[model samples]
Target: MKKERCDAASGVESIELDATVVATIRFKAVPPQLLEVDIALCDAAAAGQVDMYNSTPLFVAATGGCTGAVDTLLKHGAEISCSVLYETCHYGQAEAVAILLDHGAKVFANTGQQNPMCAAARPGSVKILELLHECGFDINPSDQGMISTPLHEASEIGYVAVVEWLLTHGANVDATDGAGKTSLHHAVNRRHSDVVTSLLDHGAQADIQDTVRSYRASRGKYDIVQLLLANVSNTQRNLTVTS
Candidate 1:
């Protein structure tokens, strides 16, 4: 029986649970010794200490650890976790991601509820998205950020392919952000016609309005009147029109 770490305990409190209970929190914070030792490994790799990332658990040949020290870690047998790799990959580090995958990092490692697939869409990296998919990532994971899915992130950022991939992968097309504004709401507010169209094609609510009045005012260009007319249900539309 193993217990996942919790913030409630002041110190290291261990619990015993069956594998299912332990399954969710797989990647606990590594020990300080490992972090320090891994730094040396990363430094060595950065200096070309390793030929390629190829080791189980990837502590060896991981060129990416702590972002800045990626190249260094690869030399000493340090494979980066999937989330960090995807994040850097989103920033266009194709070689870095390739190395991590080569070294046997799990593409499905959902890092703290933020999946690598979400990271790929955040930066609008089509290459990163493709690579992660090729490696078998869940394109439409339910994990979200502040009430937003990866599709919402891509739509908000005007990432066309990201939005497309998410829709194709079965992302909830009408998914709302923390603000309760749907993807279409974000696109229209941001004036991204392409994103707006993409979202609409996938059945995003056209008339979803910002519950926050201030947010609506912030987007002076958005026509709250027209949006309400087009997207609301006939019953609601009639009521609003009559009122």
Candidate 2:
């Protein structure tokens, strides 16, 4: 997961540099003062001077891995629901995810544009997907003001594993968006062939043209045109032979 910013660079120290540390370092284009803070925290951790619950240390550790500061915060007690605490989870910070979970971070707490489960699905992280499920996130909860479900997002983004996981967990294959279009509509419109195949295999309707067809036709897949036509031809043949 990508780190939005490094809290460790703010004159605090954390324990155990993890992915977030790498992320911060990679973003060296940031201001030198900000860079100094991260260096100080990393230095303190290396020197064993940083303690947990210092917001900087906590944010660093919460964004990834088991740092001494993180452990200290947990041992001495810290608010897991801190507003800034959501960044690590939003970026798909797995190790930090585990640490936060151990520290009782609210898994159900909404983060980003959606819940962590949905956010994880966007990145197609199977580990995060499984964790969110284990944490009791609904696989097909009501879309959070989006036109579609998590399946729709995953399929549109070509995240086959996420689409498969959500389906196996009872995500409706034909679940519709606000415009009454299914995941198939999203996959086809996005030209995600794999997602289209997956949705079809799971029984997504092939001919679900909605009101926006005129506007979306340029993007809608022609390959799916063949599939829909084939189904029609087969059905017509069967009807004529029977008649």
Best lDDT among the predictions, by candidate number: 2
Writing each residue's lDDT as its tens digit, candidate 2 over 1-243 gives 222334445644343444445445344455545544544444333323233333354554555443444555555444555332335655666766666666776554544334556566666777766766776666676456565677877987899888988888888888887777778777767777677677777877664444123224425566754554443346553443354
Per-residue lDDT of 69-90 in model 1, one digit per residue for the tens?
Answer: 3444454444455545645655
TM-scores for all predictions: 0.59, 0.61
Off by over 4 Å in 2: 1-76, 82-89, 106-113, 143-147, 211-221, 231-243
Model 1 spans > 4 angstroms off: 1-75, 142-147, 207-228, 239-243
> Local error of candidate 2 at 239, Å?
18
The count of backbone overlaps in candidate 1 is: 21
Q: What lDDT would candidate 1 get against the real structure?
A: 0.55
